[model samples]
Target: MGTVIVVGAGIGGVTAAVALQRCGWGVTVLERSVTLGEVGAGISVWPSAVAVLTELGVKGIDQAAALSGPTALRKPSGRWVVGAADLGVELPVMIHRAQLHGLITAEFGPGVTVRTGYLVKTVTQDDSGVLINDELRADLVIAADGLRSVIRSALHPQYAGPRYSGYTAYRGIADVRADDGGETWGQAQRFGVTQLIDGRAYWYATANQPAGQGGDLAAVIRRYGGWHDPIPAILAATDTALQNDIYDLTLPLVPFATGRIALLGDAAHAMTPNLGRGACTAIEDAGALARHLQSAPDPLTALTRYDAERRPIATKLVKRSRQIGQLGQLDNPLAVGVRDVLMSVGASAARGAAALRKMKQSRRDHSSAGS
Candidate 1:
């Protein structure tokens, strides 16, 4: 066990700190912000990420219940395309981003130290150790500095960085009643609503727009107001809206590790949020990196193993997420019609397959009981 400096104090950065500390490493987390906390509205924590947090001793998340109501995809007029249960998909537990961040940071023990408002301008490494900002030094560096990470640029200067997805996203938490929640697909635009653990509704929407086109709550309302039901109500209840021009890292992502530095989370693999797996993937990355470090003979060897284990999976996720976004954001009438029809057909087939399996299991159970 040795000293490590984790760049950025986001969810992924803090998670890496906790995992590293549990493995007997002294951890220091650096953040450029004046204060430490997340700013997002709500985030989905799938079972895989929940398990990682449990292994890291994060508590209170298990109490945050998963989605109980059926989640479905619909046309702008509320016609169902597919329900998540029809496809046997497992829904994730939705928690407020700030709450989740707090739970993870609560696990920070004496071995963990945090430095807020510290911007990492430079990082260099040798066989012995890694250096940061010309002064701070650590045996290893975990760069969890998010999509536009400076460390990532310094390491892979030749790599293409963030790529605009030709759309902008809007998100907000609404204090309104929405029992059953899911997504509504429109021509080149979409709206999704789900209940957070606290019972408040979390809603997000996307529109095909050029980058840097600014928008506000009014803009979101104008776009999605007349489309559906609870969507208008949800927006009316929201006091503020957050808008971001969606961007993901370019394909053929940079390696996760090099020498004494390892990239974690968005720094290594930033993907579109179409699959809602970006944060979950980062959590998995932290868990895997810690496991490899504990078993390997040296830090360098551990990073190599970590890269080999995580990169392929991350690559696949990035590709698959991009594909989903493309399909969901179809604008042309013919293309949208074709996409919806195909999705509906696929969902019907999935339902049939699931029923067949259930019937088979029931028959086996009855036979065993009689015997």
Candidate 2:
């Protein structure tokens, strides 16, 4: 067994801690915050991430509500561009961010220790291990510090990090019971709605805005109130809103591993929330790190394997999410029209394909019955 220090106590770092502890490693998680918890309205935990959490011994994820009903891509006027079911894609379960965080952290066993308000101002590594602030040392370091990760900046100062996406995002949990859920794309703005496990609706919106231009729930209403039916209702039922200027790591993200420290989650690859895969990706990273450590000959080898396995996949996601955000946030009238039309065409094609598959299956069943 080896000693490891995990920076940041967010979902990714805690998941990493639990994974490492289960693998017979003594894990210490350090958080700069005064207390341990997560902030955010709602998050989607896709099946891939759920598998990773299950392997790590985290429970209660199955209790989250699976997305039901048709999720659609729509215009601001509530005209549908595409229905999600037509695409034949799998959807994620919806849960409150805090509830999901609590489930992951609860899996921390006696082998894991946590220190809050402990910030690592300086991190240096030598041939033996990595040192933090000249006080704590560990055989390995897992940096999950987040999008503006201090550890990442220290490790790769030359690399330009945290590029803004030319849009700001708003998130909130609304008390309304509206059943319809999906996204509506307008000129330079977009809104999404989905029901959480608790029956509260979670809604998120994005607007083309300058970085650092702050906004709140009222601002969200002002921007999207007139768009559609439940959009206004959801806003009216909301008490508060969270806003963040969207940002993703610059293309060619820094390597996930350098020396004894391995970057996980947003530290390794941060992307826009367009795909709802940010936290899921981080959970996957933690799982991969632990898996590699179990089989590899040494910690360094494990880190190398982790880097190789995770980087390319994360890079593709970062690129794709950004592109989707660009398309969703189109402001130009002509461009928006074109995008909507293309989406409608794609959805129709997908529905036709799905119908064909079903028809073929039905024919096979009928022939078997005759036989």
Candidate 3:
């Protein structure tokens, strides 16, 4: 079996380690942080991500995940722009980022060894193998190092750093009693609320701002306080919030692979959170890397195949995410009103279609009974 080293201990890096080890490869995960953890906020593991975790036998997600009922998109005044029926998500589960990260890492066990505080200054690769920090040598290196990846910088020196989404976000947990959660849109800003498995509520807000400008949760709440019922209550109940300026790898990577190394996760495609697909895509990348490696005869070819397969879709997602962010942060009053109107019209049309389909089905059932 070949040996592979993965840099970073993020959800993507840990996931890749497990996937590769399962495919008969010796795996080592190198994390810069002494301890492994994620933000206290929540992330939604969509059905696609759920499938990936199930395939890899990752536990705790099913037990710890909070299954959501109906969600909606609404105006600040509580007018529903679109309901759950319009944007049909069959099974969406929300879990704390730190919790999910812990569960995924636990699945690795002794099969994969994780070395903390081992940050690689540079990675050099020849035709046969790559050397990390000039000490460790492996048949392949997986750079899941995240948005500020040293590996990514070494490879693409000409590329600028990540592009900001022109918005700042705050994530926190609140004890508010909210079962059905949704997003409320204010001009140039948005607030999302969802239930967590621990009987708490997870809410996040985004507002138009220049890069790197952030404030306390109270300040953020001040901007969105008068929106609706649950918004003020949820913020008031929250104690602390994680504030940061959102950024994405809007500039696409040329290729996901070079020689014996492959970039995974945010290192490859750091997308905006509007789509809520960043972590989900990384999980998908890990699975795809393992699948491609199993089929290919050599690690280089496998890495290349992984690149060809994953890069296109992830790049498209990056673009899509940014577009969604732009739409959500539109400040123009005319534009905001127009967007809300269009969304309402669309939702109404979907409901009418569903009703018509139900009526037709009932008629068909009656005719069959008569027959």
Instruction: Give the number of the best model, judged by TM-score.
Output: 1
**Which candidate, 2 or 3, would have the higher TM-score against the true structure?**
2
Range of the 10 consecutive residues with the lowest summed lDDT in candidate 1: 62-71
Deviation in angstroms for 220 in model 2? 1.1
lDDT of 1 by residue, 261-298 (tens): 99999999999999899999999999999999999999
Q: Considering every candidate listed, which one attains the maximal lDDT?
A: 2
Error of 3 at 58 (Å): 0.9
The TM-scores, one per candidate, come to 0.98, 0.97, 0.95
- Over 4 Å off, model 3: 357-371
* lDDT per residue (tens digit) for residues 103-181 in model 3: 8878885668889988799899898889998999999999999998899899989888598888999898998767768
Residue-level error in angstroms, candidate 2, position 206: 0.2
How far residue 82's Cα lies from its native spot in candidate 2, in Å, is: 0.4
Please list the C-alpha lDDT of all candidates, in the order they appear: 0.91, 0.92, 0.88
Ranking by lDDT: 2, 1, 3
- The TM-score measured for candidate 1 stands at 0.98
- Please list the Cα RMSD from the true structure of every candidate, rounded to 1 decimal place: 1.1, 1.3, 1.8
Look at candidate 3 and tell me the lDDT of residue 82. Answer: 95
Q: For model 2, name the residue pairs that clash.
A: none
Q: What is the lDDT of candidate 1?
A: 0.91
